[model samples]
Target: MKVYDVEGFPNPARVRIALAEKGATDKVEFIPVDVMGGEHRTDAFKAKNPDAVVPCLELDDGSHISQCTAITEYIDGTFDGPLLTGKTPQERARISMMNLRAESGLLNAVGDYFHHATPGLGPDLETDQCAEWGNKRKDVATRTMAYLDSVLDENDFLAGDTFSMADITAFAGLAFADFAQIDIPANLTNLSAWRAKVSARPSVSG
Candidate 1:
């Protein structure tokens, strides 16, 4: 398998963390994509992933999978290590719900703010600028931080007692938030604490 990505980017980081958690990081080949150079937008890369996004997974059979969640799912199922998505039906559903919430509310929101509100990746990539919508999404990211803090007040992890995919998504989201200059309020103590704990994990800290 090959992973096409720009290392250190938030979305790509999500998939990398997933692979590390599964102890499968060395099992696949990593193909670096020069997103800043417009390599991802090229037709050749588009053939593998029409989305033209980094962190795309190309299977041995030549099939490709885009999106962090989908790539994580494949990694979790194929690798031999701790489960990420979840084992039971209820666990899967809950993790999936929380993952979506984290992605949309924080991760994607930060992305919107970065690409639209700010001069992200320079003038070449960010062609359509919408400061108003980007600011609105920034507000959504803050609100979601509070919501996740409230949830963490009752649970050890985003999905439940165990560290699952939801935690991975939220952790990456918070990292993106930091990059976007969005601060997690000091009042969000639970969220801050949870982040500290997650940060200590080998998958992230290593």
Candidate 2:
């Protein structure tokens, strides 16, 4: 199996963390896709993912998986190691819901803000063009994370006590927010501790 990969990006990092959790990192081939240079938009890469996104996976069987969440789900089902997707119906539902919340709320918002506001990564829009949107997005991202932190405070993981895909999703968003200079407040200690734990994992460094 091969992983369409990147560095200095949160989505790829999420897949790497799932790989570590499943003990599958050494089993798969890593194919780096350069995102900073817009390599993902090249014709060759568009052939794999028409939208030209990073962190896609090409299975050994010739099937391909796109999207960070889908790739992690494939890893969970395809391997026999630790499961992040959850084992029971209720667990699956809870984790899936929370994962969606994190993806749509914290992750996407911060990414949108960063793409339009951060230097050296975007098209350099006029300040009047994206400034308000960026500021609002940053605010929403932080508020969403605070809400997520409260959820974590009540449970060891996002959905429940068991470590599941929701934790992976949230961690990716939080880490990405850090890169965008948006972070959960220090008062969100539960979320901070969880982030620390995930950061310590060897896969996260990738």
Candidate 3:
């Protein structure tokens, strides 16, 4: 397998963490796709993923898998390692719900505010910015942080007791939030403590 991604970016980081968690990082090749250099926009790259996104997983047989969660799911399911998604139906549902909330409520909101309000990925890639909409989404992202803090107050992990993809996604979201100048409020102690725990994980640097 070949993984195409840029280092340090949020989505790619999510995939990398998943790969590490599945113990599959050594089984694949890492291909750096330079988003800032517009490498992802090329026709050749587009052939693999029309969406022109990074963190794409290309199988040995030339099959392509896009979307971070889908790629993570594939890796977790295929590899013989710790499961990040879930083992049972109930667990899957809970993890998936928390995962979506982390993605949409925090990750996507931070991304929207960065791309729409601020100049994200440089001027060439950020053409249609809507400051008004972006501002609203920024507020949403902040609010979501507070909500997540409350959630963390109840449990160690986002989905349940074990570390899962929801935790990984939220970790990536918080990193993205930092890049977007969206700081987690100082009062959100639970969220901060959770971030500390997740950051210390070995998979985070994968």
Error of 1 at 196 (Å): 0.7
Query: Each model's C-alpha lDDT?
Result: 0.94, 0.82, 0.92
lDDT of 3 by residue, 75-100 (tens): 99899988899999999999999999
Residue 167 in candidate 1 has what lDDT?
91
TM-score of each: 0.99, 0.91, 0.97
Better of 1 and 2 by lDDT: 1
Q: Write the number of the candidate with greater TM-score, choosing between 2 and 3.
A: 3
Question: What's the CA error at residue 30 for candidate 2, in Å?
Answer: 0.8
Best by TM-score: 1
**Model 3 Cα shift for residue 134 (angstroms):** 1.0
Q: Write the per-residue lDDT of candidate 2 for residues 1-206, one digit (tens) a residue.
A: 99887865788888888988888888899998877677887998888888688888997778788998888899999888877888889878888899899988898888878876666274533233476677788888988888888897788788888777888888889888888888679898988988887677665754
Question: Residue by residue across 1-206, what tens digits does model 1's lDDT show?
Answer: 99999888999999999998988889999999999999999999999999988889999999999999999998999999999998999999999999999999999999999888998889999998999999999999999999999999999999999999999999999998888899999999999999999999999999
Q: Candidate 1: where is the Cα deviation over 4 Å?
A: none
Tell me how candidate 1 scores on lDDT.
Answer: 0.94
Highest-lDDT candidate? 1
- Candidate 1 RMSD computed on C-alpha atoms after optimal superposition onto the true structure: 0.6
